[model samples]
Target: MRKVWVGILMFWAGLAQAEEVVIAALGDSLTQGFGLTQAEGFVPQLETWIQSRDASVRLINAGVSGDTTAGGLARVAWTLQPEVDGLIVALGGNDLLRGIDPNEVRKNMEGIMRAAQTAQVPVLLIGMQASNNFGTEYKADFDRVFPELAKSYDAAFLPSFFAGLSDGEGPQDPAALRQWFQADGIHPNADGVSLIVEAVGPKLEGLIAKIDAVGE
Candidate 1:
């Protein structure tokens, strides 16, 4: 009876530990928690949100300020340690700011997807739109890169991560964009991070369930 009880305890312990899921929010300053303290950035806040549900999901912020798609690609291998279960790819803003070729962005992002596939991790791509100032041709190309990649990769696609809060016409619908960003008009404030957490929480939850089922 003693031995059986010990084995049962061990099994439950293993099950408890298995509840933990590590999520990598890999991108630029946004991922780095720009304009906010470590606690306020999306990663920490997102973890809190996850905890509110399962209390076991971990969010790893791998944001690099001023990083381009190529930059993200360069570091993909090292960042995607096998223990990680999911990825939030929020890049290419710098590329758009520099007016880099959309083709380059697409290629770089594809590389990212390939690396994640090699690691057997699911990805959640955060798409960004080109600033309207960049001209229609450039805008179209930049916007197209994300959906194209999402479809090809079969990743979770948040059509506009910052959708309703987007720069121009988006925020006009009272209380849409203001709640997500600070006065600076750049980084997401704490409230904004909360909104993000709310938006992505369900999807992350579903992903976790799927992974758990497969592991079982």
Candidate 2:
């Protein structure tokens, strides 16, 4: 009876541990929560959002300010550690800002995905739209990379990280769009972070489902 009770306790403990999922968010300044407090950053806000929905998950902020796809690629292998259950690849804005070749961005992104795949972890790729400063042809090329990579890798995809923040009311209504952004018109403020968390929360739930399924 004593031995049987010990076995039961051990099993339950293991099961409890299995229920706790860890996810890594790999990206640039947006993911890093630039110009925001630690609590106000994307990762913490996202954690709050996920926990509010009753998910037993932890998110690691692997975001670096000004990191391009190549920079993300360089560190992906180390980022997908043994205990990490899933990955969120949110990169390429810097690449667009710097006008790096779209093809090169695609290659670096592919490397990151392959690294995650090789580690046997699931991935969620977040897309970024180019600003008009980059021109139509460049914008088109840069915008296509995320969905293409997501489809190719069979990873989950979120079309744009800033989805709900931009209402199509046009630049005439700066307040609608500007309200969510910081002074630089780039990084999101605390409220902007909340909006992003709300927009991507559903997709994150889907990714969490995948992680749970894999664990099972």
Candidate 3:
């Protein structure tokens, strides 16, 4: 009957809506796509990357230019909206740049992780390595903050936001790696973002899988 067909159509539509997965990327300028255009930034490239694999997902960009781990901690709760089913935490770059102590960065990052945990949202945490200029002890301590936190929470982890840029032969000079970065020698260029997305996209796909573990 016509009435039975209409009811079935609406039921299917509601089923489709319930399966949608929304994720939030919480970070600093890198996540904010700081020098890049609307389409060329990290979130857009990442979204394109995921959809190409036939996954349905939406990403919320919660990146703030010049924001530090402390700032991320402050804003994480609101970023985890009711619709957000997953998260990508990529803060601490600005904190490293400012020479903030690793302990403080770790504490702030832990706070963000706790907020996500409380919200019952899955997370994919990406981190940045410290420059040697920050000194041996500082570098070691800063480098450990991210992985340690990820381990504590059992969240997915990527050691560096720039993981795709490395040649993997060995350490390369910053001057040598300039092709991938903007003129500021800080934020990555569009081409650089492309490489990063290719490498980093898979890990986030895993997060999506975790969030959808219940169904669809």
Error of 1 at 78 (Å): 0.7
Give one digit per residue, the lDDT tens place, for model 2 in 100-212.
98889989999999998888899988898776676888878888888998998888888888875764311234466788889998788999899888877888888888777
Model 2 residue 171 CA deviation (Å) reads 9.8
List residue ranges in candidate 2 displaced over 4 A. Answer: 1-14, 167-175
TM-score of 2: 0.90
Predicted structure 3: lDDT:
0.88
Q: Which stretches of candidate 1 lie over 4 Å from their true place?
A: 1-11, 164-180, 213-216
**What digit string (tens of lDDT, one per residue) describes model 1 on residues 1-216?**
999999999999999777778878889987788889889887887788789874587888899999999999999888898778888898987898899999999999999999987888888887887766778998898999998998887787766555535454223443556566788767778877776667666666766665565467
Model 2 score (lDDT) = 0.87
Candidate 1 global lDDT: 0.79
Clashing pairs in 2: none
lDDT of each: 0.79, 0.87, 0.88
Of models 2 and 3, which has the larger lDDT?
A: 3
